[model samples]
Target chain A: MSGPAYTPTDEELAHLQKLSSEFEPEVTGPLVGERQSSSAITTEYANADPVYRVKTAALPSKYSHYRTCRGDGHCGWRAIAFTYFEALLRLGDRNRFLEEETRLRSMGNLLNSIGFQEHLYEDFADECFDLLRKTESLVSAGNDERAAAELLASFNDVGVSMAIITYFKLLTSAWIQTHPNDFAPFLDLGQDIRQYCSTQIEPSVCEIDHVGMSALAEVLVKQAGFALEVLYLDRSAGEEINTYRFDPVSNDGLPLHNPPTLRLLYRPGHYDILYKMEDVQQPAIPQAPLHVALADYADEFVPMPTSRGMSDVMSLIPGMYPTGLGQNWPSVSYDYNPSPIPQPQMAAVPTYTSVPVPTTSQEYVNTAHHNVPLESPVGMSLNPPMTIERGGPFRPSMYELEPGFQSNHSQSLPFQTSIFRNSHYNTAHFLNPDFQPEEWSPDSEYVTGSRSRHKSASQ
Target chain B: MSSSRSQTPTKRLLNELQTYQSDPNDALVELGPVSDNELTHWTAVMKGVPGTAYEGGRWKLDIRIPSNYPNAPPEVKFVTRICHPNVNFKTGEICLDLLKTSWSPAYTITTTLTSIQQLLTSAEPDSPLNVDIAQLFRLGDFVGAEALIRYYTESERWEGRQSV
Candidate 1:
């Protein structure tokens, strides 16, 4: 017999409380899954509600790829953390990694300012920084694929990934505490910021909420000049997924034109990483070698035409042969001046020198002298008009010369023209596989006359 | 793989042990690994808060740390019977949220014990592990609760000492 008649009810309540506290939803999958085509999401929702089906079906066209974060309660935090590193890796810039590390390390002061014990938080912080340095080394070694694999592996390791999530949670907490005015209005009325963080942000099991996401984006993503975009896939009367974007702004308060972005797909409680088609492009390294090979092939096969008819026609152009007519035109061809006035001439010289001689009465008879085969019909049909537009005197041969010629010319004129400098084909371009940001050199600016000439050509 | 899995918690536990040794908390009487080879199993002796009914009594705690140590909160329960609303009298289970869902990697064993010490002074009667004790506090029977807490604190004080 129980001592009190009400004891049975109390026992039942206590048992239920214990059960609720210990209950964990069944979560199965890699902690952070491999990136896969987002069309898989459409397949997943195909049999579900029509709203989700429609939204998921439209997903891949916009967000081409996705990475799953296991549906454990920490999915939101893990998704953001995984995508932040991924966005950095997509940049393929070694110095960006170093800059991020320095920026994160400096936030230790923010952790300290919020009364977070340095020794206690440092373990989590160190795990994060160590991953950054590891990623930096991988990126510097030009092993992007391996670096990406290592990043995914680290995040999938429950211990390492959870440590990073915890560290981010702490940063978000500190950020909220430091900037209460921005976040306090979002909290329950009269609720203390510290109490809210302890209950909702710092807890390892707590899923990230809207306020926490904002704070995290502010401290982590936006400050690093990276944008955060979340696409909400909910049944809220819309055919399309609702998107919320937090864009990074420059110090002058203008939004950055196209900052590196970390994107997430939110399905109610769970979050997964989402990527656009451009986000998954391989670094430009492999294409460079192919271009070089094409250049070599063009150099071996193209006949240098010496047709007097072509020279006579070329002499008629105003800016052609700027050193005057009949003044060793071959020597003039070698001038390599990228000035706007001689660009037409330079374009003509490369066409005649590198392109197979087109079939003309004068050159057709002389074609046998070069010992190269005649142009194919396809090459003949495409070449003549392009050569004329490029201001060459000869009808363009079917064999296009630019691919090989540009690669060859690039070596001699490292920064060809403003257009070339701005193009993605330049090694200095961020999209290039070998992305190295152009650094200003005082010696090159002052010592080289050619550098100034190239600068003026850009204008 | 197993060794690497255990490495982080092991290293973290050692750092915590060193930190405690260098600057031990006033509320903690003793805290460390139960044996030299087993870093995961720890034992801590915590003094009750100075102004609480359980004052002058020392409570022994058994702490089982998971291999994923700071990422996962260490399991802590009292070894000595204590009279508190938020602590079980029959079994030594505690009802503090800090030891459960509110746990953060920033918490150390010493800090957790300090929180337990604080918990002794400020019991949450609404969510009680010891229903009778909670009923007394809810009914505002302060004198009766204090008498019961003091009686257990004195009687069960030496129950687990020899084992430690």
Candidate 2:
């Protein structure tokens, strides 16, 4: 290498240096883009190297959806922060939002212990807290679509988004500082943790490195009982993207079962959110009302002559009606024995059926018409139909008589018998459209034993 | 969206002004908006750090805040000329990372001014805006650097006082 033929003078050199120093790569896009199909990623990589094509081709199958974060140096932090609130929204739990607010607020002590100025950091922290409250209200109101839209809108606001990112960055710094033993080994020889944090973690223009990501996962994601997963989509000679998961654990140190996970797709220097098919599943909450209403209608109106004929016709269609039809129908008909049943069960059924279907013709006209008002009393009458139906020739189990019995039974009954666990009738079985995994509970183990014995004796 | 874009910075600036008013830092001679109607453009007066070569000098700073203040850092520069490694003598532009990439929403006007005052006592010669002054400091010629700094500070101090 030799000097250029026309060597620049000092003044020219200074101007060139200033230009180079001021050079910023032109960045364009929303701060956080709308959720889009991950298949677009596959298409983007289709013309690239074979490795990228292979990896991205496999991406959509596992991670069905992805949202892009603007690659202006804060993508990783913004991705994690956006996903954290999004994971909370996915939970759709009101108290979880409050609990998270309190948990983050209490971390002020952590922030304070590390000498972070409270009054200064509080402005950023307030933005995060305000977002949580806003999302909490939306989730509480059962407006998840609006909640999600509002979340995307909030993050798109540069000031609000940067505030949250700054707050999270400070938290990550504080966490790393407090847990030096966990992170110090990753630093250069004898490098001060505080120096590394100020340089690499706290700077607004510094993208999150691996160490910062781990600290953020520990401080924010894991503490909230949500897992954090990073999928490396690089040319690492693999057909599938490599995945690294940080699972939240119970107090006993076991990874929590099926915890809601926050996932990020890391392609060298940038990060975007990834979603498993299960993650974007319309929360079972909205659908549960429709299911309950149909189940209730079937229970109440099945005893009526016309509706029984309709169900008989429905049963003729293979797989349209659930199995055990003969057993359930006989029991339901038995319950219709004009025996002057329990006043509570009679009142519950009539109240639901009467209010929703004002005219007799409307009741029999079409099932779809009842969907609107049927959703209102889902919270109230979910268990009553099962209770009334169980008040037949078969002895009602103590569990069935309890409030919230249907949900508990639906979740746990698959485990009561191996035959049921393997059968399509178990909602926990994968063949079911609304497949829910059978969650094992220590309290339910005893109930399972008693119910199994009672059921075996009845058989 | 536009209203909210301005509202957050204005609110934060007001809160910062109140905090600065209630508990002012000793190093800052005065800090506030240039005009009551405009919060984004302001002025600051800082006393040079004690026991430094630039001591006994009053430095006026031009502070131009972005619409998204706190999120985006305020631009602070010297209005009264002084000689230093990290400050441009003619342009008054500073080379501190705090006003650039390292800026955070946590920093307020008072805290930033305090940092600027601190920057006088701890000049980084390695990444300097004024190559001539930085060369003096880099060559371990502190006496020469101090003389040049004092000459500029004292001469500029008189000019600054007259202008005020």
Candidate 3:
């Protein structure tokens, strides 16, 4: 036996391993987490661990909030599955929920073709369907907050959560089987695609890899149209987390325009959801437009007359002259970000610079205020703030003549000047104004193709 | 979480029971829980194929599924002892890959039992649990192995009747 095996008596290493093993969590409960406020994540991890400190510190800039998921092996599937339901609930569209329910039930065909009987996955699929049905009733009753809360509750329940997770695993496994040729070249781990899926991907506690994530994304994104981005926070030599986008294309090969409805913070071993604080805040703040000028550079670069232009001009006039006229423009930055109607890319204007607006305590108000109409239609209430609240549409405004109002939040450059200078926008345009977004529609061309190509190349 | 955890296995077991009861495979197999209140422990009684060496044999398996039933595979063993190269004669432990690492949640109690039945017809001699029987079969001693298997089946059947 080549004498005795070589062994090292590393005392410090043994001590560290013992200490870490003590923290290795037991998988006793269901594979889900109670939805925590995004800020709570910062409070929970910002100080205790340096790695998490780096992750949490960088998280709040791009993602102003994050919900910590349970660190079970099923975190990847559970996080995405919970987000799928929550996204539907946030849309508050029952018909869409029903359509999703139908589509999920139909995935039984994928399972069946792979030789699983109906009863095996029927119970799990039924649990998901039942959750959808219950959520729909709650949403339709105008209890969106309750609907969201209850949905999270159900996720924590073991039976329902595992069922959904299992069904997800099965469908992903089936996808690998049904399209073996598509997956074959990439199964380079000295195992066939089926063995890899069964051994490494389908089990309840198996953490997913790039192929697993993409396979699940192929099934879900195509069926549900929910775009996903996973910011991988690893030991890589970067201040920012590496982002991976998973957006499956339609049959026509045209990429769906669904904005990344779900964002996940992926540490080496686990995944959790990230929230944009701007999207979650309620419109309740003293009208200071405190950082309006820095953000207003977006106004000077306005290129066209759109509804977004009118809203920006309307929102700006008050911020432009908060104390000049007797107009009380209660901090309208909430209106600055959450435009109910989809608008043109005013946020991406090349000349504009992005400045991080530090969030105030009052911004913690729940996202329920998202439904409040942007502006009163009749404009009878001449309160500048109230007028912006009722400003439903741009209604062919003569105000288009105003130059500073051309850009909207969509045009807001994704690169915000972080309080931490280390937090540079990884994109080339952070320093260059001549960056032609037209060469690549930064918003439309999702990172999916590039990521899949990378995965294929690695294979 | 514990209640829900138990509920999934129970619910799956009940669903399988109902499916088996409704569409009974009368000629081939009979399966049900050991007691009405117990879903995790089941009894599967299967008949030998008509023309195989195991013809006229009756076998009963003790199927004890874990609380994580479908996710984790069931523990199956022969309550009615029989001789086969791939099975331990004393413990009735199987040497089938499906009952081991190859298990998937898609495999139900019915599918598992059926695979065991197939294993009987076509035993994998190379990976044998009963090395003596495997050696006999390897040495073109089919008659010796068949006689022993038939005798073991009959003795097991009579022992079952006597217990009843």
Q: What is the C-alpha lDDT profile of model 1 across A250-305, one tens digit per residue?
A: 55455554456798999998999988644665643321110011111232222223
Candidate achieving higher lDDT, 2 or 3: 2
Query: How would you encode candidate 3's per-residue C-alpha lDDT over A43-70 as one tens digit per residue?
Result: 6675655665555554543465667667
RMSD vs true structure, all candidates: 20.3, 17.9, 17.6
What residue runs in model 3 are displaced by over 4 Å at the alpha carbon? A1-25, A28-30, A37-56, A189-207, A248-252, A258-260, A278-459, B1-14, B21-28, B35-39, B47-58, B66-68, B82-90, B93-103, B118-164
Looking at model 3, residue B27 earns an lDDT score of 38
Best candidate, TM-score: 2
Question: What number of clashing residue pairs does each candidate have, in the order they appear?
Answer: 3, 0, 14
Over A1-459, each residue of candidate 2 has an lDDT whose tens digit, in order, gives: 656797888999989998999998888999999888877897898799988876676566456689999999899999999999998898888878988898899889989998888877887888899999999999899899999988999999887888889999999999999999999999889889998998789877789999999999989988787889898988897455777888765444545544677999999999999886556766543321110111112221111232322322221222222122122222221111122233343333211110111111111111221121112232444332332343334444544444565665444545358887688877778998867677767667877789899999999
Ranking by TM-score: 2, 1, 3
In terms of lDDT, the poorest run of 10 residues in model 2 chain A is A354-363
- What TM-score should be assigned to candidate 3? 0.61
Indicate the residue-level lDDT of A443 in model 2: 62
Report the error of model 1 at residue A81, Å: 0.9
Q: Name the lDDT value of residue A449 in candidate 2.
A: 83
